[model samples]
Target: MSTVDNPWELTRAIAPRRYVNRMIAEADGVIRSNSYPSKYPVNGNPPTTPWAMDLTSLDGRFWFAAFDLDAKTPEAFEQASEDLGVLVRILRDTGLPHVVCRSSPTGGFHVWVPLAGIDKAVMVQLADAARAVLPTLDHGMLCNDRTGAVRPPGAPHARGGASTVMGGADDVDVLRTPTVTAGDLLRVTAAFRELRPTVDPADSSPTGPVDARHRAHRSLPAWGEAHMATVAGGRDPSRTGYLCLLAAAVSGWTLADVEHAAKTAPGMEHYRTRNRPTGGRERRTAAEAAARLERQWAKAQERAVLYRYAPEERAQRDLTELTGIVDVVDAMLLAFTASPGRWTRTEADLHDSTVLTYLAWLSLRTGSRDVAAALRSVAIATGIPSSTVDRSLRRLHEAGWISRRRQADGPNAAIWRLSGRFSTPGEHVGPLHDVTARPPAELFDVRAALLEVLEDRITAGRHDVFTRAGLGPTARRTYESLTTTENAVHTVAERAGLPRGRTRAALASLRRYALVVVSAAGWRRRRLDYRTQAAKKLGGKVHGALQRRELQYRDERDLWAWWQDHLIRKGGRRGRDRVPTTQAVLFRAEDERGGPEAYPLYPCSSDGRADHQAAMRFVRGGLLQDLRDLELAA
Candidate 1:
């Protein structure tokens, strides 16, 4: 039985590593002391098909982890066994996958693959294919869900969990890894949930043995082919506030449930480290001291924000002092700013480089779908290894970061959408619009109509055509009487069917369906000021850049150099501080011909995915190398 203090030790123990066998051997030296009789049922051979999935601890407070499995561990290594059952059911014809675990904190899980005679890779392929209809799942507050599901970079509980497949009953199977039980997940969840936001990072010294009870139960008497091993890789990580987050997902509790419990838990009410009850000043002297402390603290945070703040900030205090927390926050901010995505490096993040790299890989991979040389190009750009990339992707799928589905052909690329929930586009952790894109099918009708209107406008009867569209009737009459003698009565009345009070709604729908333009023209039709969404993000980046004077190589004089460095190639200069026009493409396709042969490809907007893929396919097939000299000269 795991408790609130060490809710994830089991996870850390079981997480996959480059040398998993070695790590398990080392952990066994000490795990024997905590061992107990198993309470969970075991389906070692997986009478039914099996699949495994469970959460991993990233920041412990801000993120979650997940992975999939096909076989159970030998024995005594049941970790996240129960959660695996839930994940497995989505991939096979099983209603619930069996779970196996020892205690529960940080131990890896083993799932018995179905006896379907499917190859290991094929089983994984099938499991990936049948994963939940959506590409994300909820593993408590920590979500190792789909990539590019934008969230506030620094916000907590931003990920949407793992990808959860939903289709046939028991499509996913859950076999035990080291012979543990499923209910243990619930038990551990309950225990950890007791403490939350109260566990201040400043006071959390989560680096020791937690003597919790071992609660295990197993029942698979009907199956004869069960094998178990006394392996030692389980538990996840610390779960103070992290535990409270799980309660919401496990019990379907409201955000209110999580927020209240976590925010007011013991050991963290004020969440102060060395300073306590400084809530209100007791005496005049204390009050003055408090004021000075506030000023100093504010200044310290500023210093921490600087890119190289680790030395000064880390030396200032221990974990118990709020200084430690200030330092951690500073680190998180820096990590977030450097790379805006699913995971950022920080002092508080879990010390699992593999997991972090895997998360980054997903973010890059998902967003670069249209880029032909995506994987290889990004490897060069970021200096990451291919094996690390491959492993991370495998683990992420197991954990539910994204889903894998069979392509229409032999090998299929899994399609991932960031946690498929209605989160405000980018309103995740810090500040970014993370809205889910609306499927194009739903907006087809509206878009089709709008396109017709645009095509008709080419005839040139009257330029100001809003009034005739029932958008600006009064304004329409004014324009018509002033511009041309021809009357647009038919056009005006036909569109006038739009409800009187719903002019704005109609226009909004049109815009959503890609049917209307929202320039000065749309404003005139709706009789509303077309306020542009605040460009806070762009402004913030610019402000930060200027303050740091980081643009050292900016081309202040040469226009061509400036255009290439930035993704722009057209338009006059906007100003020194602003980019003129972000025309991303510079040269036409095949422009290397060096003459009019490629001139027809002018107005260099890329052919997007198609052209790039053609180029890459040629490269992949060794065609590029064969014609390298000729192509280069052309």
Candidate 2:
């Protein structure tokens, strides 16, 4: 074949230096390859063997925004070909340059649009816009940043035939010519936006007059109004406003309706003001505020498309009964606690168990196995930090104890569902002996009784003890287990669902405070008042340990604050230079002695040190209670 006609040359035009290859054989059914990219001479002839080109470069830039369409039979292939024609017409109408190729002998199609060094996220969005029109497009091809390789034109397919350009060498020139720029992609996205169906209030109810529509928007739910009025530290105002607008949009409110509600709502005064350049707030003109509301209203409409509720659905939601399944969930927790090997082997494992148990309880209390909760909400409910709760959720999902059904979006918490192991009746096999099969009683307030049971098992209701004693979940759980009965270290570890070493260490710590005692049989708790005994035991040698630690933490925080001020004063240092220096100062106290190890840092480099100091402050605040509790006990 000539240079323009050569399949390898055509492939090299789009991905010249980075391509993978595989041996062509019928037995090689899988798409496995250990091949790495290597440079090839641009002027050289095509390689003798078939090769595939990576869609994304090593530096995370996309060479082409591509789509694949496959069919299992000839009839399906014909149908797919018709859909391909429709897609081609759409692209042609939008003036997007593209290339089409027969990807395999079994009749899969690959459509490629050359991109000018576009990022993966933007490329995915462009593809999504196209997929909205053609739903049959295979999403896996560009589902993530690390998209797999595609067999280039002229490359041999393992199944039989070689990939061929659809219009032959005539259309191959587009791959090497001027490509689709970001501006072009944006224009196409805008065109696709026009194709999206307009929101219809008729789906909610009969089309109403302008005043009737305003009345509908004014009927905000209690939760929606609360979200709009909430103003708290660490909260994003933009996010709060967007969620409030989304709540209205999903309820079938128009843009005018949303703006009117924002202006008239009692607690929505913040929406009328804009920050000045001098760092002072000023009330915006009506036109300026309306423009801002319009932008937010558009975003809310796009996001709430999937969640929009009909009139009946919204009206009946409040009337639905909240039947509690505390009995069933309690049984599930009992079973999970008894089987330590299934969920627990380490301190982190115990945390995952605790989070999973709490999620089950929340799900049952809501009268469904599906629960919607934010990380902060879960943290508040379980007394675990938000960061730890996030990790526990990941672990629970990975271990098949729970699964996230939907991600959190505007005004909506993430929806999580208990797995079959907990949700399915008669599936929990443990010492509970089929307690989950029993009929649940209707309890008016299950929270108090449920909390007592959880505290007895996992110390879930002991935030005060956690703060006062500086005890983490694992240590608290071990202590709770010991309080029930005297038991060997191994037995206590089993009951607490912790590692033997951690259980032993907890025992030693408690013994140091005279809260526990060792005997020939096992370990037992002392009957004396724990706070008084602990105070008297630690009064002398360890009396000032907490104060010293607090001082040290405060000094470290001050050092970080000074560094930040120094950077601000200097004013010319880049972020790269500031982060390492700030981090060094923040962690300067760490050495051979025990210090905060594995301290969680914020992902943003600029705020990482500040966030670390905030965590330290929280720790020091917790220690204040320790001192006060000890003094009172003494």
Candidate 3:
């Protein structure tokens, strides 16, 4: 095979007859108008901008299969490069002809294999077979019909480079490459399956005696079984069914085992008849239904490789479980707070502690430590921004308080578990105090009330009301101590499991907002609408502070933009070095000026360029407009 002289011709030849689309990219590699059915130029010659094409033709036949290997970091890029070699070897072994290209300026790659017009179902099975062998393959690409368009070869990558042919095959004619037939794909799939040893469910004894760990590995965990059972009544039956297959795969079950279990499991009855057409007059035959199950099982096995449980993790899973919310709350309080008083030493410490407490409560309420919650949900519950919540979760993970099982994707939330570090509470920390006077059974209800109160306060112009109203960790505990009745400072301290000094300060802060009132009888929560009153009291000061912050942000943004322009003019230096140079200049000036407000654009130690990018996004997201609206309301 000889690479074509014009890559655009290759791209045109590969794209579907209809539904070719165009996409534009920003300087920073962010794509705009990325959705499907976008406008594509009529004349070929490959538009100056990036473009995408549907994988399937108008007739619903797949013309090619592509794998996108995205690498976000240098280490990942190196690994992806290695994996690319493995993928090429696999294809060569299967006697399949393919094309390879550098997908971006970064070390990401894309490999496209031409296929004769094949049914989508057969294409999917071929993709799954490849996925089982190559875990790094992007499963989202060819998994469904509505997967949207993919940037074709010869297109401009969003990340500031052209997608160019790789592997010294520039002379290869991509358009004339030989295509794999459906029969060839099926043969390759069978060869791939042969690589894995098959397990039989009917035989109690294997060739060798199975140990306890091996036996455990071959059966679904309690949680997996529960998730699988959800298929019976879940709104999204397909998702639950996939989860079941994933569970089976993670438990080390083979395709045969999964098929057998699906045939027998009560919750999986629907899987037995999945071969029925949407409105067909007759049901599919038993053999056809079994074949359908085999295909799904193969796909799930591929995806499950990423989530397989490690030996240590399997042992630690039991230790992560909690008996009830009380146990979770007590464990978190003990692990996060300082001894004797359960008090946090600094604001940052307090924030982490509060976030952990909230996550623990959520886990217990869900009857599992594996809590799948979005950052937004946690932010709303804790009265913090989503970014801050993310940071707090990372901190908790670093501190051995939690372990993230899976990162959130699309509509799915991240799954986190209270780790084995705090499995056993140190000792009875004293009678667990119920400051909200809420019954332990009403965990979610109390969370709803807290969210409502927080929303009202924020909407009325009081941001971070929890901290502003002296509801810091210590203060919140103190205030809760007085929920049932008034108490003296020392008594409140004891009830709140805090130092007397901390209790007194909390009471003073609460009293300032009239959230709690003090008299000769001690301090008690005010009977009035505290949320409304607090918002009213803090609105002016909060808005003024926000306005000042916005002004500073605008100044920094303008300065950064100016610096970029200046650097571009001076030496035309661009890409990675420019950002570090700009940040260095800003830092030097900040040192010379010597003040808290002097270098507002200075990079944070934890995240250098990311901090600057966030500031830019903050301005772009219309925070300034929101501030103007607030000012007008005032």
* TM-scores of all candidate predictions against the true structure: 0.19, 0.33, 0.33
Q: In order, how many clashes per candidate?
A: 104, 0, 7
Show model 2 residue runs off by greater than 4 Å: 1-4, 16-18, 23-45, 143-147, 168-170, 192-634
For 1-634, candidate 2 gives per-residue lDDT tens digits of: 1223566666656673454544432355453332434434435666544556777777877767667766444433533554465456456667888877777667667777777777765555555555543334565575345746677666776546777666522376777764788777767655544332222222221111112212334666644555455542002233345556766876678877777767754334336754221123467688767766775576466444323211111211321233224545665666655777665666677667767766765554345657776665555445555677799898878877778899976336788987656535435566875453311111322322453344344322233333333545566677767642346788787767667997899888777766676875477655332533354454443334433443554445434443444344346542111122112323323322113221222212465334455544544454423332333334
Model 1: per-residue Cα lDDT at residue 620: 39
Off by over 4 Å in 3: 1-5, 25-37, 41-45, 168-174, 194-634
In model 2, the number of clashes is 0
Ranking by lDDT: 2, 3, 1
Candidate 1 per-residue C-alpha lDDT over 1-634 given as tens digits, one digit per residue, 9 for 90 to 100: 1112321232233332111111011243432211122211221221111112222212221121223322112111111222343334322322324322221122232222222111222222222222311112122112232120111111111111222222222222222133222332333222222211111123222221322332112221111001101011012121222222322233344444333432323311111111111112122244443333333233222222221211111221222233222222223323333432333122112111223322232322222211122222222222233343445545555655334442222122234322222111233574345643332221222222222222122111111222122222222222212111111333222232222234345445334433233442122121111111111222443223322222221221122222332232223322122222233445443333232221111112355222433433443343422343344346
lDDT accuracy of residue 297 in candidate 2: 70
Tell me the lDDT of candidate 3.
Answer: 0.52
Q: Which structure among the candidates has the greatest lDDT?
A: 2
lDDT of each: 0.25, 0.54, 0.52
Q: Best to worst by TM-score, what's the order?
A: 3, 2, 1
